[model samples]
Target: MNLLVRRLFWISFAVCGTVSLVWGHDVGEGDLKVTVLAKSSDAWDDKPLPHYPTGQPEITVLKIIIPEGKKTPLHFHSVINAAVLLKGEVDVHMPAGETKKLKAGESLIEVVDKAHWGENVGQGDAEFLVFYAGEKGEKITHVLHGDETPEAVLQEANR
Candidate 1:
């Protein structure tokens, strides 16, 4: 009877230990969550980022606000730039007719040296944080007149 009782105790202990090891660990929720918006080796158009000018790097960050129904002039970034929409919605249009709509909490890796424009399409004001990776004294953006072609712009930039 003593041997049987001892055997039963050991078996129960082993079963309880195994069950605790398998199911007793805590799986608690975290306070904050992070989502990656964009991760790319190239720009939106699949082109490599342009080389930074030979000088100390200059970084520029701007909080741009676009009133409802407003549109940006056709322009292009000479340096690598990106933006994260903070408040509302915007339609980004390229000269080649491609368009992308970005909303709050979304981010974009903008095209470099490509002509494009942005229009606020939301009911309220649109806001975004634009960041430029450039060199000091270099022009970060070039706004085009209505009739200018990208070829002409590139030529002027080279001269």
Candidate 2:
């Protein structure tokens, strides 16, 4: 595991332990089923993972649900991110005409600094958790509306 992933695992472990203590339960006492869904140093498209941005490191985790038949506008992320599709399916489209269909229980190391979007291709809502590794005050996503840049989005976000 990389340093960043190790740190995140320890942090999550600490939190789980603390919560168990507070709730009068042992997190590891039950029939624990541990599984590694995905692990890679490259994006799903086989590109090498980019280096983390230098600054005060910050992590953002978001749970997004896209309703069936709904499509998100083209967007890009300036920071590194990974996601796990917890429910339903999504057809992810790249600007170069490449596409990937991610199903429930799958994971993906997302394409950073590239234009892409997703559409729900399942019978129900598509739910996923996206974890963004970035610096403090960094924008994780920038919606593209033809020729828009991340800098411009940041400027607009600050306002």
- Give per-residue lDDT, candidate 2, residue 146: 78
Number of the top-ranking candidate, with lDDT as the measure: 2
Model 1 pairs whose backbones collide: none
RMSD of 2: 5.1
Error of 2 at 141 (Å): 0.2
Candidate 1, superposed: residue stretches over 4 Å from native: 1-33
Candidate 2, backbone clash total:
0
lDDT of each: 0.76, 0.78
Q: In model 2, what are the clashing residue pairs, if there are any?
A: none
lDDT, residue 58, candidate 1: 64
**If scored against the real structure, what TM-score would every candidate get?**
0.74, 0.77
Q: What is candidate 1's lDDT per residue for 1-159, written digit by digit as tens?
A: 454345334433432334434344544433333355666647777777655455555667889999999999998888777788999999999978899889998988888888998999998999998877666778888899978866688788889
lDDT over C-alpha atoms for residue 141 of model 1: 81
